[model samples]
Target chain A: MKSNEVRVARFDGYERVMHWMAALSFLYAALTGLAIWSPVLYWMAALSGGGFVIRGTHPWSGVLFTAVIGWMFARWAKTMGLDADDRVWLTRMDKYATHQHDALPESGKFNAGQKMLFWSQVVTALLLMVSGVVLWFPEWMPRSLRLVAIAMHPLAAIGSIAGIIVHIYMGTMSVPRSMRAMLLGWVTPNWARLHHPKWYREWRGSTNLR
Target chain B: MLVAKLIDTTLCIGCKACEVACQEWNDQEYTLGTFNGSYQTMPDLAPNFWNLIKFNEVQRNGAEAWLMSKYQCMHCADAGCLAACPAPGAITQLANGTVDFVHENCIGCGYCITGCPFDVPKLSPASKKVYKCSLCSDRTAVGLEPACIKTCPTNCLTFGERDEMIRVAEIRTRELKADGFKDAGIYNPAGVGGTNVIYVLNDAKQPEQYGLPKDPIIPWTVQLWKGPLKALGAMVFMGSILGAFFHYVVFGPQQEEAADEVE
Candidate 1:
């Protein structure tokens, strides 16, 4: 955070804004959904509006999140794809978890774990949207389909919520400069070189061209 | 005393007086009945129209027989609507076996509709709240019979203690069997742990002919979703948080090593 530190561009301003939109909407929808999922968590409804209001607005929030996710997929799908290096990184995940980062493959813009998070989020979001629509308009669907949706919606929600919890924990606690990159769209060259050597090298090459 | 209503289908004349009384007492809007080629009025129960008389014409021994029966919430002892409802106290089973809907607490999610084995709960399009028969808890709490029972002129609908009502229904079933209804029996389906509304059917072998399910049970999907599925989801949610916390405590934050930084 020194003023004289050499900084490298990570996320752009538009990407940061889009990420916040996705995060906020996802949190709202997940909270409201949890409120309506069980009476034990019914108290969560009081935190937002009431039970009826949460029930009504939860699906709309889900729609907003799905829209943001679509934007993210279009923007980052190319970089987020898994490759040979990512597979190598995945195999060395135990080392990564144990802070043996030197043993893992060089990371690019996103690490293997981040790519996995992105893909899992995409899958769970798709499940939520389809099942959410079915639940919202139950009268339009057959009982069998509705039954499947009622079950699928919660399962997908559980998956996404748990994944996001880990994402949040990693972003804010486990890694230091990750949140700053998402917030200010910049990270120090040393930080990037330490965490994502391939990305730092690519940025250095692009800057040298200019 | 667990109060109940015993409906003797043999004594019913398909007059629908109980339905009329129910509408009048509940102050529901007057709905025009279409000619569905039957004496029965509406196709099914509506949010406002809680009680109904279903008329089913069946061929028995090559003779046309009309099976007329009053239909409403069964008020099961193990009420599925109450079980599946996420909104606390929105749907509750009273001490007298009446399943009541507190519309104020209703989130209008329609989970009750899916949970109900009888498909009794209907979501009101206007209010967005689910509604069903209250078994006239208001009147019964004040020592008065339900409007439907009081208005039934043929003594077909009778209200009393649950045990006494079952006894009365058993007697009626015996009398019906003696009078050539060989399959006459009482219907208080045990699948839902019996119901406050018991019926003495002339042809109990085919309750479906009376517009009643032979083996009505809470949908297994709802049971699984609200029961073990909910428990599993909670466990996973907590497990993830605790796992993250324990990881943070054990390995600490993965900070950058000073030697790795090339300033």
Candidate 2:
């Protein structure tokens, strides 16, 4: 039971849809990508009709994922900007890892962990896109260039996947009530207060009618 | 059983019939690129195109050289992408040692992109799906050769049982070594749990000479960061769910007044 007095819409309906779309698309890319890469999960191709289907679907879904993530970046990049508090919070990540909620520093709309996830996504997305393009056009370029692209693409994908695992954990499991913002586009006052007191206060102080 | 490929680069004529056949058999469209280049039209593997032939010009032994090889999924045994996938239906292993993909169960996290050692998978923009080469599973289901194998004018690519392929690769490597290729050897038999697609290089050159990794391993960070965190997160999720269920069952629903008071 929580108070309903301090309610606010943290995300718009479109934003929530985009967030989920990005999430879903990214998931598709990751799974099929793995199926193509290794025999250990070659069975995954059955999900897409077979290995060929996974192959056909992986890149197109990646493009869609990148597009949606790009939209999410535009919508949230400003709020996700790092600040002094974020630095302090990042330096004290061990507290969060140990589940020391009381010692956890207060944050804004996005915490230090969330900000790191955002920026990692941004950098990895750029790297995957660039490397993917080179891979896509190997015949058009010199072999040396194609080899470089091949090497860089996998490395970038690996880093991005690792970042995403952390992002998913923080968003869905570790932080209570955080997923509700993305799910319902709103947050209860108490939840906002507990997790993002600064953002809660800012929203309370705002003169906007909504 | 460890599967391998013995790709004889010398046998490759750079005709690209293999690429065309793969596209045709897979019902993929021709990926046309800039017009001014040689017959190297289909640029690379996309969500649509699963296979491609790469052309390389190098200064080998201080002499100008041209090299060509067909490229597709390597099908590593300890696939990074498989280990990284979060969804259950995303990736699976087949009976014949081929890795497969499932689309209906996919949630599109893109974890596989990072897990792959070869970076083979590509994302499509229009349909929001992921795609890669599956080694012609459809054709194999009917006991037919892969389209690329059937259409290769030079017989550069071959498909067969995993064990038989490895045996042939070894014999070919030995023969190539006797034929003046002192460095000829099979690639990726034990590298990543053994690749199903084997390569027979043109000469006794390192795999790096033809743009393949000498040693590919799942990145340590995956084990370090994702492996443990995913397990811990699942535990938390289950614990939270069970805790909420227990609280509701034991304490019963809260009265409106009590709920209001807590708030």
Report the number of the highest-lDDT candidate. 1
Worst 10 residues of 1 chain B by lDDT: B254-263
> What interface Cα RMSD is found for model 1?
3.1
lDDT of 2 by residue, B124-153 (tens): 665545677877777776878778888877
Maximum-DockQ candidate:
1
lDDT of 1 by residue, B139-227 (tens): 99899999999999999999999999999988888888889989999999999999999999988899999999999887777787788
Candidate 1 versus truth, CA RMSD in Å, comes to 2.2
* Weakest ten-residue segment in model 1 chain A by summed lDDT: A1-10
Worst 10 residues of 2 chain A by lDDT: A137-146
Off by over 4 Å in 1: A1-4, B257-263
**Candidate 1 docking classification:** medium
Cα interface RMSD of each candidate: 3.1, 10.5
Best-fitting candidate, scored by TM-score? 1
Error of 1 at B119 (Å): 1.1
